[model samples]
Target: MPAASITIIFSPYHVGLRNHRVGDGPNRIRALGLIPQLEALGVTVHIDEIPPVDDFEGEIGRSFEVLRRTSLAVSKARDGNSFPFILSGNCMASVGAACGLGIKDLNFIYFDAHDDMDTPSTNENGYFDAMGLSMLAGKSWHWHTEQIPGYAPMNYKDRFLYVGLRDVNETQRKTVAEAGADVIWGDAGKAVDFPGELEKRLDKRDMSPSLVHLDLDVLDKSVGMVNGFESEGGLQEEDVMRCMSLLPKKATPVSFTMCSFNPNLGDGDKIAGIGIRAAVAFVEALIATSVVSVQQ
Candidate 1:
């Protein structure tokens, strides 16, 4: 464990949207199960929890606090010449990871069913948390991204790959199109690469350094998505796991953060748990490959 890479579980529940499900449990609580499972991966996880902050303004305020703590913790750890971090968080928690994992720049592989590019201005809800990806992409955000100092101008071309888009508002679709983003849409796109296509996608990014964020609802409701909007044409656990196995190791240190998982979705929890377990398997594959390649 001393030499194994660290998996920082940055769980900021303040902006935590309890995933409402029928005959099921809450997402945040269900997420508790992920901790022990992740520990089995031979990585240390830092589960950072902030109370529950509901709206945009409140979420933004507390996020700053969480970000500061995460930064301090990471800085005190080591020279950080180690592998890129494996992070997990709620909503805007990814933003904190984006800010904290500022090692030689990082490309964000944002996997969600929704485009999440709506700005405060374009948002029908006028909410900020819903518009996190927009802020992270340096598009436009409520105040969460705009007001945050020392972390904007967020890398675009050299960073950011989008996957599993199904229910996107026109604005977010437009944002992705205009951003020259490399997106994997529908099953066709998801099926494009095995281990090779994903490798190229991540490595192709000018910066190469990157991280992966998985929004659990990216799966179809049939599969039992607890929280977040689920869309049709989402990837099955096998396909998603296959893609994960293909990611380029030399590109950057990686972390897999999944959100919007509602425990209450009766079966959704099973589906959510399986999706995450599949992901853990993918990481195990990476570890095996890393070890095997070294021994050879």
Candidate 2:
């Protein structure tokens, strides 16, 4: 009943957060609830860890390695009949999965409260987790900037889209502008009606596959629960759903990531359960779209 075996990898690595909390945050978050719902929806959960951190190049190297491993795991998951697989991870783990998927000239539909666009040297601290996007774009340390070879790195070019970003640094703005990418602010008041919007927007830019990464913080801290570094001027759950509704028909193997769920949303069980349900709905919607295409 578990969708013929889906690899639900829980990345326990917390290589990014400057402020630390529970040592078993990953396990605790998982236990709060997700397994039962996913199983009931016909999904098998395969929990596992990535290769240990390396010391030579510090955390960044380990981070890159994990991305590559995630890619490998994803590839294996996709073998034979392609069932919708799920991956739950932290910040840098998201980076690894992006690398794992060979997205050339990729368009990133990044939904988060922050830009995650800070270059390493530019960051006040030498934290790889904080600078995942910058390094992916080949914009950071010469060594760490390398993405999986031949894979399209996460450049801010025509390939980037930021939704629900109400807080950011100046460097991120300049970088985003340099790439001429589009950024959508998540104001609760403004309605997102821009004239057949998404199509008009995508039609105006490059035509390629996309990587959609949704950081849990995009939702108001009240609705989704337990996010990393909560911010003001947040997006409502409906707004987030509206954004998800715009996923196109032709985007190949669309990759979606739900990241940095801090497990602090009030009534942990309800919060985590609903969060998992929302995530699963997104995936289920993706598969249903495939069915719609077949019938049409």
Candidate 3:
């Protein structure tokens, strides 16, 4: 089989919050030598950095602008037949990833500690990052998303699976239930069969290309809190790896995004190291799955 090739797109703008250091996540990951590690695995890696947009309007404006740029970069990578591995500061980047793939019908697997299902009316903190999944499901933010070229809201709510969610409020939970989206609560131990459960869910849905969205906060604080919003009783490194390994078998992963790694909030080196290892494991797993699929 041919060697697995991947394009790494870095988005360094954390426009979700004002005056936050989450924007520095991509640089820190690069500085820690993620590319060399992937190369060591015998994978062809291409790096594309998305320039930060300087929007004078506000956080929301800046967020949309960054998503647009990321969408374009991801689209180009897909057009070239390179698997896009997006390393972004905010989870909202998922919008761009979905748009770039240009799939009208796709499954979404979101791994995060928080539900990220808040709408403008439901969000008390007024944080844009908190409403990423909501926007992706076409639950809100229609006016802003219309401005982004090639952006289409995903109306198929039942096609999404929310994993490792433990930080959700009553409002978010109600919204998620209303959307009929599946949820797998976070487990500190190996009590849940993550891969098997996920496979079962996918089997029930239509076979379509899927996208995996990983928020570093899905990991337990002990493993390394990559962002400020760290919740307890999260998945361990092995659990995360196992779940990611099983993802491709259930559905074709057209693209993936790893987001919400704020190096300034915790031990920068430690958090970055953990993130690098996780990212490498995910890519390696994808390659292995691809090879197996081809052989079959």
Alpha-carbon lDDT, every model: 0.55, 0.56, 0.77
The regions of model 3 sitting more than 4 angstroms off are 1-4, 16-20, 187-196, 199-207, 291-296
Candidate 1 per-residue C-alpha lDDT over 54-115 given as tens digits, one digit per residue, 9 for 90 to 100: 44355456555554444444443323423323233445556656655555466777667776
Candidate 2: Cα lDDT at 32: 61
Cα TM-score of candidate 2: 0.77
Using TM-score as the measure, name the better of candidate 1 and candidate 3: 3
Model 3, range 1-296, lDDT digits (tens) per residue?
32246889888778744325777887788899999998777777888887656644778788888777778888888777678889888888888888878888878888888888888889988768998777777778888887666777776467778878878788878887887778887765546655566677777875457788988888877777578788776777777777777777667778889888888876777777777887777777777776322112
Tens-place lDDT digits, model 2, residues 1-296: 11244455555555522223321345555676666665555545454445454542545555566566666665555452233233444565556566665556656777778777677566764544667776666666546435454345565666676777766677766766886668776665555542135455666665456767777677665564554466656665665565565554434434556666655445445545545666656555554555212111
Clash number for candidate 2: 4
Q: Please tell me which predicted candidate would have the highest lDDT against the true structure.
A: 3
Q: What is the C-alpha local distance difference test score of candidate 3?
A: 0.77
Cα error of candidate 1 at position 91, Å:
2.8
What is the full ranking by TM-score, best candidate first?
A: 3, 2, 1
Instruction: Tell me, by TM-score, which candidate is best.
Output: 3
